[model samples]
Target: MKKTTLLLAGLLLVSQLGMAEMKKDVKFTEKTYGVCSREMSVEVVDGKIASFSAVRGCPGNLNALSKLLPGMEVERVIDLLDDNYCSGAPLAGYTSCMDNLVEMLKYHVMGEGEGHIQEIRKNQKAGRKVVAFNGHICSGCGLCNAQLS
Candidate 1:
């Protein structure tokens, strides 16, 4: 499932429709905290990531994320990285690039209190846990911990 989502995101990133029109754009800057990645700036054009910049994070990993992120749909990128952890392990008990990006999109790109994420919120409020697994590889951490944040 992770592979499929990643593949789809990669394909969506390079869509011809997105590539054809680069003028229409939206820029959003999200501040990340309690983690290695401190800040991120994302520019979307035609519903796809056109440019990405990160502040105060791992150069190699952040560089790769920046490269692979552009040309991907905002939603798909969120799906791919929603549960990603820094170095693929629990660290600082905070979100990684993917999770922070989702938070940003949930409010900015997707709009406040809107879209399918609202459903997730509803379910979570109803005692359901909204989880994103990296192919079910559990990190043995409380991702669904309500006390977090």
Candidate 2:
């Protein structure tokens, strides 16, 4: 019983130490690609920042994330959308709907690297349309103008 108690106490102490290692002044780099928010939370842990989960969409949660990131080390931030997802017009409505909201998203990404930003464009005359990141459009989706408006 004593041995078990000692082991348990050791584990608890280690857990507390691990939790204390997360730094509050960690720096995060945010990037937006295809309606996904990619944020790289960087912090030094045991002389290096340990790896963590990839960033997805964070809606109105920037402050919370920023607070959590100070001590947490995030190695990567990736957007999950691919050419196939865009080609099917799955994001058409979102893109069109986001036109008016681009400014808001831009401000969010710029002011705080905390969430995903997506943009979509359709050009019937060119027989091609693209959903893009910032200004670089990629992947053509079938027409879905009504959904965007």
- For model 1, residues 1-149, the per-residue Cα lDDT tens digits are 99999999889887854543323367978666334667789898988889888887778888998899889987788787776545442222235656666766665676544432343334334543333343343332435433221
lDDT of 2 by residue, 41-128 (tens): 3333443233323355444444454454333222221121112232222344343212212322222322322233423332322445
User: What global local distance difference test value does model 1 have?
Assistant: 0.61
Q: Residue 8 of candidate 2: its Cα lDDT?
A: 100
Model 1 pairs whose backbones collide: 13-71, 13-72
lDDT of all predictions: 0.61, 0.36
Give me the runs in candidate 1 sitting further than 4 Å from their true place. 1-24, 87-94, 112-149
Question: Each model's TM-score?
Answer: 0.54, 0.23
Model 2: lowest-lDDT 10 consecutive positions: 75-84
lDDT of 2: 0.36
Q: Candidate 2: count the clashes.
A: 6
Count of backbone collisions within predicted model 1: 2
Give the Cα-based TM-score of candidate 2 against the true structure: 0.23
